[model samples]
Target: MDDARPPRARHRPGAERWFRPPDEERRGPAGTRPPWLSTLLVTAVVLIGSGFAGRNQPQRVPLDHVGYALLCAGGVLLLFRHRFPRTVTCGTAAMTAGYLAAGYPYGPVFAITALGVFAGIVGGHRRVAWAALGGLWLSHLVLAHWLYAWLPPAHDHAAPWGQELIVTAWAVAVVAVSELVRVRREQLAKVRAERAAAARRRADEERLRIARELHDVLAHSISVINVQAGVGLALLDDDPEQARTALTTIKAASKEALGEVRHVLDTLRAPGDAPRSPAPGLDRLPELTEQAKGAGLAVDVTTEGGHTALPPGTDLAAFRIVQEALTNIVRHSGSRTARVLLRYGPRSLEIGVDDDGPATTGQGEPAGGGNGLVGMRERAAALGGTVEAGPRADGGFRVRARIPLAAPPGRATGTDTVTPDATEEES
Candidate 1:
């Protein structure tokens, strides 16, 4: 037996509208329908349906067919709006206002009207949209109460005040939703800009870290080898006994440099799996001076006050300050002797390195490109420390640095020496 439902309630055999996909749904952009065309189509559907219902009504306003014609034209113009939003919105608003004045009497054409205004809010300048909305409100009030006095009843007169309140509330609702969408778009743009800036900062910092590590590893090892090579070449004709000791220093320095490079590479590859042994810290100052002495520079070290444990970053900064200073001496100073002083205090630690090298003067200053000083300053600044380098008043060149005893993460330790607890601190 056939189902005993009403024919309208049943899925009728010939009602094809439900089964056929909308042209917009079938052929539009993946997620969004073209705004102008979508607005036009929606208005057309409302207009045509309303026109059929009102066909037999008397035409109280002028040029009834002309009003319908303008609406149809306006709707068609709206279809291209997304490609040209401002122009389409302006045209639609002008035409729709005219239709309302001509007594088209609020058909489904209002849907297209609302969409055009929303498009203006979304795509046009805030001032323009505000001006347009204000003008629309004035027009609506004039038409409903003044020009069409005998036509439809005014909103506040015929309907209860609550009805007027409902219409006003809905207008506010529309504007609120549109503003929310605008704010979200701006926020997304801001987030993207911040992300791009952060990426650039990380790239620059990584490059600097790599350069500093290379400097530390190569400068010490190379300086040692250079010193030993000089000794070996000189002793070739003289005392071969001392020459053997120089060669051993060269071999040991090379091996240590290689190990340091490997350590840095491993840390870069998997920081979590990096060896427990840390980078050289401030406590290694004695060793650094001895290494320089082995390279033929007589160095003196002085430490003042009972040594307090330094923060890891601060310790590293202290070490780098000393290292860079010694490296600078190796490169520029023509002197054979240097002094390193480490002063520890309650709040901070100070390091100073000076050499009695020949004063750099005459033909255009020593041309070592001044980057050693820059690297030293950068190291100190990273740990909230400050560095000063210049010619000493006592006819020598000095590199001095001050590093904070402690700092938060992501801050510079003012040294390459990253210290942690007591274990790594000793090394």
Candidate 2:
């Protein structure tokens, strides 16, 4: 049941190439037909059409045949209007003037000539086109007068003047439409190019931001592993049992770091990959509070209003804000007690983290010089939210973030929490 057929030859040996010259060696003589033969074909059509229209004119001139020939040739050159507008226009103008002066039948033939001249002028120059229009009208006026006088029946001379005005207006209309099309095309191209460039710039910035995040995540975790390993090595010679415990902590930390690294790498490898794991959210504050406690920081968690699950971005922002705030406490706060309060309200969620540690006593010495606060602010700002951090009035540092609970733009929620922690004026 084979239905396949043999392929046929695409070309004949002796015939000219369908679209190209047969003589591969003969690059035609200079000024001969161009590689784009279509241009030549179009020129032939324009010339022949205009020529036949002109040849049929019943006009009596001493060199009527010569005028007709020149008109046909000029029409052919006019086909190059877009390519060499000025040259074609000037040549066509000369030929048309010659045809009119040779006493062609004025009405129908003059109309065709006027159209050709109009094309040339629009393609050439606006001022020149208008000037040519005026000149042609004057010529027609004079010719009409001659015809009126020569004909047996009297003809109205005013009639020809009105006709001249109408033709001139048509020429002006053509010029306006052509210029409008050209201008619109240029504007469209510019807008498209600008938009494309802007998109590319945004993509590059996103990539750079991702790179920075990956570096931050790796550096922080790896640094912790390094410090723990060093401590374990030092203790190994003195207290083997304690060293083993530190080694176990190191193993756990390294494994967690490897998972985070793999998640980041996989995201980079396949852009369409799903979320690695749900990002930490406000509901996980208890776990975070415990982690801080484990790291030897005393923390108190307070809730005000009944809490509800939040939008993913808002939840993530709240969690990170608290995490960074706690990290700062451990790193900078020499205090034994820190407090985290989550306040959920009708419009927004307010998070406040504070530590009653005495301020570090130096300029440019971050009580914990770092980007923790900066990270918190950035996360909030991305969600049309805001955050503030400064030393508390009484004594200590405080960090607060406000995240809107309103679902981001196009989402709906039916069963979300209604209230947040309501603690005020704590001692």
Q: Which of the numbered candidates is closest to the native, going by highest TM-score?
A: 1
State the lDDT of candidate 1 residue by residue for 227-290, as single tens digits. Answer: 7889988996698878888888888888888988887777666644645468778777777777
Candidate 1 achieves a global lDDT of 0.64
lDDT per residue for candidate 2 within 129-248, as digits (tens), equals 556555655655665556545532233333445676676676567566545544554454465467666556545534543543454455444544555677688889999987787677
> What are the clash counts of all predictions, listed in order?
11, 10
- Poorest 10 consecutive residues of model 1 by lDDT? 418-427
TM of each candidate vs. truth: 0.70, 0.63
Q: Which 10 successive residues of model 2 have the least lDDT summed?
A: 418-427
Candidate 2, lDDT over the whole model: 0.56
